[model samples]
Target: MVKTARPRGRPPKDADPAPMEDVLQAALHSFATHGFNGVSVRTLNRELGVSHNLLHQRYGSKEGIWRTAVDWGFGQLTEKLSAADDESAPPLDRLRTFIRTFIHVSAEHPELLRLMNIEGGEPSDRLDYISERFIEPQMARFQQIWDELAKRGETKDVPQEVMYFMITSGGGAMFASRALTERLFTSRPLEPEHYAAYADQFTDLIMGALKD
Candidate 1:
């Protein structure tokens, strides 16, 4: 009897356990670029050089990966916002810190904004999940801060929802509109200094408007 050789090309399944964080990062980028329906397990597997079985095992399904990716992205933003909003600081200072931190994070992770834009343009379960899990909670926290400022008469009476929308959508545009920003500033590439300057200007503009 002749002994048959085992498969040479594919390694044993246990040989390479998937690095979950790396998978999430890749999934985040893919979902951000392609939205929910545009991405597939096969595509992700090919891109990450992992098996579809691994992704399924880790996330359960494509929707699971989408949910996880959205959670991961917003989790990062929430942490940054929480750190920036120091309760020990004065309200205005805390507000400034929050705005600057938000702009900085937006610049660093433009993919977050892109993904949100894509989700906002469509009506789907993925969008509903993001709204419940991320958007509503963050907006509530922001409204709480504004309410405190209003009680102290530091800020004028403005619609909290409008202000929240302006802060996120307007600030996001600075980083999201890369082509327009680059064309507008043809002499220089957008760097850290540019983002810093924009943050300062954005804070000043919002503060001024709120006071007025």
Candidate 2:
């Protein structure tokens, strides 16, 4: 498949060139939609229309590219999550911030959850890599927020595991269920302004349920 060329406009001043950004995004979407076992460096190069030897030279193998793409994705998510708050707010407010931040990120990068869902279907090193490298650490931060909320009497007596899934999988499904969303809502990709509004509403809904 020939990748449709996107416009390459001039970047703003001091903008660091991320040459691999598009490649990693495409790789994530491919892995998400097609499954890890279904994709390869050869397929990536063929679809992406890059030099046949380029990905192999840079990444060494399909596994290497998969790891790098996954890392790039989670790294961006972690950065966005960290930028949402500085951890100085109240427990409840911090929880709200987390919810909003996640919702926005979900809208921006639905492929992330899709890829995880595919990998979660069966045991594999890919599953383990994402779990240990990304999911666990992020969940730890979520658990910290939950603990703080518990201390402040802001959260209910729900199991932390259930709450975690409710936010990550349940809430994210509203956005990440792209096939459904496109049919019911719009075919175009979600933009930041629209996601910001959705995040506000979604965050309020979660905070309402959590607050005593």
Candidate 3:
């Protein structure tokens, strides 16, 4: 053997690298709290404890990082929605499942709603990109499901866009208004149990209202 040349320049570090998901999650939180124009690569690197060069190397630019972060956040929601839509159940059950799932996802990832709200507050390329890449597709899918339910006589004949807005905005309110939610419910914490109970009640309320 040639002694392996001492494995090149130096020994491997014992520290494990951060996963892409973790990076994206951190970016999501940062970008959601501070809009794209408000955040800097250096700030993100400092918060993440990584080099600024890493963000540039991986995403090429701040815009690229914003795009990736938005994609990652919405990708998670899309996966959950797709799974709920695919479940082999009655139309009404599927509708309820979708509503509950949406609320649960919003509660679990409040950053998603925050980021969306921030983007929606101002007109920019970032907002347009997110709308085109994530929001439109998600809305289309939900519209298809809603239309199916209506055709099956399971749900009321409501416009797709109206129902979509009702479900997303209404279900996301608890998560999107953290300060208000905490202040209003000062006696108790907004724990997972609270979210679960809310999801159940919200699903019932929406489904009841959507009945023919």
Candidate 4:
């Protein structure tokens, strides 16, 4: 069998991470504003005031810069989420806390969340990386909560997969729905007020479905 070419090394030893960060921030903004496929290297170069050669020399390719931006965004997000998980509350309470905090943060960081949603639709080589790095660990946390509920005979016939879907997807949809919700109602934000409503609705709906 023919050998595939391996990926290159990290940035040069003397290279500053700052310029790379600028490129990443610019790329992420473009991706979130337009989309992953909609962005071009020229567009990124214009945004960052960097030459095409600098971008390539530092990042290898546009795909490399995009991946770096996506990874950095997710890394920041995971830091906040893991911090939320570390709060000294019980499991279910902790889940709700995390959800509330997540929605609050999403409202504050729409571009970041938009980047994530956009990446979900793109042809990404980092799907497993994203999941394993962020989603799976959180899923395991939820699984522990679900296990406790099940032992108490408080759960339904629904599988843990469905429970995971309901919980996580509900939060995902809540954050994603803000744009549409903003169109219908004006003069009010979704984070504190409307987000609470959605969270309560989601919790009630999920609890009703899961509870025997």
Worst 10 residues of 1 by lDDT: 185-194
Model 1 agreement with the true structure over 33-152: per-residue lDDT tens digits = 888889999999878776658888878899898888878888898888887787888878878887888877887777788888989897888789888987788777777777789899
Q: Total clashing residue pairs per candidate? A: 0, 0, 0, 0
What lDDT does candidate 3 reach at residue 41?
91
Candidate 2 per-residue lDDT, tens place, 1-212, comes to 99998659955322432368888888888988899788877788767767677787778888888899999998888888888866888878778888889878888888888887899889998899899988888789888888877787767878977877787887778667877877887865465667888888888887887664
lDDT (Cα atoms) of all candidates against the true structure: 0.81, 0.81, 0.81, 0.65
Highest-TM-score candidate: 2
TM-scores, each model vs. reference: 0.83, 0.86, 0.84, 0.67
Candidate 1 accuracy as TM-score: 0.83
TM-score of candidate 4 on Cα atoms, chains taken together: 0.67
Regions of candidate 1 where Cα sits further than 4 Å from its true position = 1-18, 183-189
In candidate 2, position 83 carries an lDDT of 86
**Candidate 3 TM-score, C-alpha based:** 0.84
The residue-level lDDT of candidate 1 at 66 comes to 82
RMSD of each: 4.1, 7.8, 3.9, 10.7
lDDT of 4: 0.65
